[model samples]
Target chain A: MNKKNNLLQCPNPQTECKECPIRKMALFRDVPEDDLGWMQEFRNSQYLLPAREILFRQGETAHTLYTLFDGWLIIFKILDNGKRQILRFLLPGDFFGFQVNSIGPTGGYLHSSLALMDSTLCAFPTTQLRLMMEKQPQLAIRLAEMEMHDMNLCQHHLIGTGRKNAQERIAFLLLELFHRVRLQKQNDYDESSNSIIFPLTQEDIGDAVGLTSAHVNRTLREMEKKGWTQCQGKYLTIRNEEALSKTGQFDPRIIISKPLI
Target chain B: MNKKNNLLQCPNPQTECKECPIRKMALFRDVPEDDLGWMQEFRNSQYLLPAREILFRQGETAHTLYTLFDGWLIIFKILDNGKRQILRFLLPGDFFGFQVNSIGPTGGYLHSSLALMDSTLCAFPTTQLRLMMEKQPQLAIRLAEMEMHDMNLCQHHLIGTGRKNAQERIAFLLLELFHRVRLQKQNDYDESSNSIIFPLTQEDIGDAVGLTSAHVNRTLREMEKKGWTQCQGKYLTIRNEEALSKTGQFDPRIIISKPLI
Candidate 1:
């Protein structure tokens, strides 16, 4: 409801939970079809966030949980020193907004989220989550599974920032987003092509991987010079997947898996 | 089951679940007293991991999840370049061993865990987790809550490694562990004293906070010179909690909260 955040409420009307295109991969993946009517009732609304707009700010009281219905988003924390750390890149069907100090007095969001592109998100009131889970136990299991997946991604980023060099980190981020985009069957990904629409600026890449924008630029140039990969005009293409994967120590199998939901 | 991992089975004939000292902070924290009987039946066994012993290695098939009943442990990953990243430190009542590539062919553990000192753990078959949760709905909710807590910590560490300088990172780690140890009411944390039995070496600190052992050494020495903290023998004491917290940007309230279970 924060107007300056550029959140447009009920964009294109609410999509029925039972007919959700990404239902197979969404939070309700395991819910029995007969149980979906309640889920529809539980969902507060759908909102469209314009590209580069703030979805939620860090330390804001968290009132709802979200499922990214479409487009990309980044969850990040800005440190006391004003440096930003992008925690995770969320794709369609990804559930988020649970990163709060639930037992604390403030119960604020631990990090802020921003739309990498125009995005749509389905919202569910936080207070009713427990009741919903009690009614549909599978939802709890699905949530646990989703959290595990996100935790893995977080750990991977920790490893990158803590141990990997600039080139390796950048390569890892690119390949990760590439694999995620392709695997998710996003419209931007073509079956016959290795390129995908990449929306992150060099600064965003730097923030995500703990590098300076200059460092990211230089490293990316080196990677491109090696004929391993290329990023131009908001498109990233893997020219030699084997070499890039080797450089990044990326194992596609670790990232490509069935939707836990 | 791996002999080289130094796991001792059936340590002390398994404490009765109904009388578990740390039950209030554990996976079954919210389960009704009547339901604990089923949990006791579900627990596969108890194991003791000796000081500096590997509990489980990365890439091993993950069969069991663990709940730490005593002592200290750390979960970490070794990079292709042989650099290590300490992901999380586990205290008594902490649950772990869920970091695995669940949907992959290998179905392997994503990282390795090691006991900092002699530690006890309760094991449950990973395969039966869903079955257990299905029978006990509160278990699923508790698991989600626990995962959310763990995710928050992971995000914090990611922020530290990605944004904070060496001193800030070290301070954060120390304050975090100190608060956690004291708040958990561990035997080592005397109610009248500010010290706790610290087990991590400088190298371990380095791995956890993305610094070198020498750098960690210098930072600790500096903090000591300032009369802010001390780590002597196996004990770490906070002499100036306020100063250290300010330097670390630590909010004890964020880490000190009622157990979600």
Candidate 2:
């Protein structure tokens, strides 16, 4: 795969559904083992999106949905005035690309998704969604559960931006991403260390938390000075988790919902 | 039904599924006529919530999910600092009460819901959702579609609070509510009139748009002074729809998604 380009179509044979490491946490988590072959047939292909590259853009006709196999992505909307609002931060095991203005064949994506790091995604044709749901009712239930989870996070962010101050918003966002990364149980997270691989820039943080990059920078400095957190060399260390949680009013329990399926 | 208390148990017979006035726009919109009787059996009861009454509170154990047969409601979360963030404005035919931290039987609501006006709601047991979805897969598909629609609205609000100015946020919210009210094709909305029965107070607008009541009031006055809108005697009239849409970057098409079922 070319690291310089936006996206590269991986030439390797598609990973079997039964062998997928992330399947246990994905959209098909509830499908029985016997049904793995059927699901594998439905998946289109796997693609690699290079860091800082857009996987898809807003208003583009959407033909596929993707399950993040690896890496981080941001789903965002750019306003008419040229400002961007980050709607969601996607981590591995996250299923996305379903937000659209219409469900019709010609419907366009409502937001653009860009990879924060080189990401691998398992793709599925949008046209098969309904049929697949009908065949496996559990999938629809899982989708509803997933959407509810995403909605909960969206509301949490709304609370942060709408009611919380800059310090609170930044703290809440950092804690949220931290908890989410840990939840994925991936290799990047080390239990022995107090830090995770932080890929978001100050501007990205500002877009997600509704602040200017300068404001985010100042708040980060304040947080660092207080010995609550450290964001340097692309790593975020939670030196004082209790203090940060208190300041942010964040409870990690909110991210621990069980899969209904 | 008594108007003095928050909730009133109506003695009136439950409305039959087939006879429900708002069924076409509700959760059971796509249920076949022959299936209405089965759905009616699953419905528990109907209750009345008087204007300015609490329907449910955050952290309360949730046993029932509701479909608003009539009237307005607001879903909100209150911060520890006593601030409130209005998440979604519910309209007639809107189904809600499923926002929970967990889907387990002991799950509690993550937000509070309040009736903005005299409202009637049809109730269903939460425990029956999965069973019913299994029996009627179309219902599950319909639910996912509804959730996607709601997620879109939530994302829209995120953008308003994160990127748009006070004027733009207010304009966008007003236009959004206006368009949604009109879409219902109900008695409250008159084809000849440019106004709907606006039930929200300035504080409500403030909470939803991430502004202070004073700021919302000032912005509304400015918009009114410019001959763009009028808010008086519980009515909101859009005198300049085009200009308001331009300012808000609002598009009616976003709210006109086809029901996937």
Candidate 3:
């Protein structure tokens, strides 16, 4: 008898996780009965960090895979001149820090990940996680699919940096965040909404979009003036999602999805 | 027996393709026998054109997947301000033009791709491809994987736009292109005294790296002066691949791959 709650036991410090509340998460949902029980044994809760709190830093060895239970996190990269680019917004049920040795040695660093909002997640050892992947091709395939989606988001950022003006770039980022976060759980947007609680600062947005902080500020003001979005510090609301997307030049169909692991 | 040469079926009026030397590259390489025969029936060559030829106009329905067989192609996006941003370079045997159904209708005019050098390819119809994908999970999975790689390249472009300096960006792109092209076949550099015969115009390279043609020209001269590369018109012969990579701030491990399809 494998219940969602069955006295989780593991040696790792983050092994306290068992009965997570996030329902939309597709990871491990399709695991067979016996494997699900086995997975529950390897789970744990490492720590909960609030917005701007660092979970890991660049050049740090990744020791565990994190499955977000709640809250938001931003993964990003920083330049030598101290500029930073927010890569993506990680939400509940999103898994990070996982690797597949079958591919090659994992090299990319966790450049920027701080809580965008207070967040919780289950952490599992990378080696053990690999065992699960090797045992379950579906899991490995799912991870690859997730990476594909992450890549699509980055592709859009390339457009923003290489071409779109600051205003258009910022508008697109907000719209993307809103739509992505909405899927984890209904917060403020539908399939497409510009209104979502994004944790990135204007400076962060500027860096990702290849603009200055002052430019980001000016763009936000302009967007508000145009009635495309309502910005209140870190909190934002989109007045017209359609109009907002045009600003970012984002393609909605790029959200190619596969069966979640 | 399955072969990769069946990409030469006649379709469009541009059917002056029968005698083309690079007849439908070896795409069905290692494809299972059953799948190869089916793919052959859908292959079309008349739909293809020489380098700089429009495969499909921007915003045009992404009706076919173009697989490079004999030359190089540039995948790029045009901005509202009429500036064209070269996203990345696609090589022979590479696949692009995969679109998710729900994403915006990207057909006929949003972005345009032209051959950087005279090239050949096989085009697969969108309708037949989709139907085949629905039936072949592996093909869909392979397409998704390619999309992931293309997206990674996009992330690299974003870095070029947002983080790296102009020199670093140029160096990075050079090292990347060298590694990619070399992996498949030796470029001009290898065939003649370790000099790469990079045949891209400064304007094209500028569009790719988000630099003005003048700036790109200046940068090329600077690289020549620094002994980092030898650029005489469109022919670039890398002085030292390893030393050049150092200038690009590249960790060869990042560019390392096992020839994924």
In candidate 3, stretches whose alpha carbon ends up further than 4 angstroms from where it belongs are A1-47, A98-112, A127-141, A187-195, A225-228, A239-243, A250-261, B1-48, B100-111, B122-148, B186-193, B240-247, B258-261
Give per-residue CA lDDT, model 1, range A210-230, as digits (tens). Answer: 999999999989999999899
lDDT of 3 by residue, B162-255 (tens): 7776777788888777677665654333444544447678787777777788998888788888888877765567786676666555655554
> How would you encode candidate 2's per-residue C-alpha lDDT over A40-65 as one tens digit per residue?
88888888998999887776777788
Q: Which CAPRI tier for candidate 1? A: medium
TM-score of chain A of each: 0.93, 0.93, 0.81
Listed in order, the DockQ scores are: 0.57, 0.57, 0.28
Q: What digit string (tens of lDDT, one per residue) describes model 1 on residues B29-121?
A: 889999889878879888888899998787777788889999999998888899999998999888887643222336777788898999999
Query: After superposing candidate 2, which stretches have Cα over 4 Å from the reference?
Result: A1-5, A101-106, A186-189, A259-261, B1-5, B100-106, B186-189, B259-261
Q: What's the best-to-worst order under TM-score?
A: 2, 1, 3
Each candidate's fnat: 0.60, 0.61, 0.36
lDDT of 3 by residue, A162-193 (tens): 66667777878887776666665555336554
Tell me the TM-score for chain B of model 1. Answer: 0.93
Looking at candidate 3, what is the lDDT of residue B13?
48
After superposing candidate 1 on the true structure, give the runs of residues whose Cα lies further than 4 Å from its correct spot: A1-5, A11-13, A101-105, A186-189, A257-261, B1-5, B11-13, B101-105, B186-189, B257-261
Give DockQ: model 1. 0.57
lDDT of 3 at A121: 65
Which candidate's lDDT is highest? 2
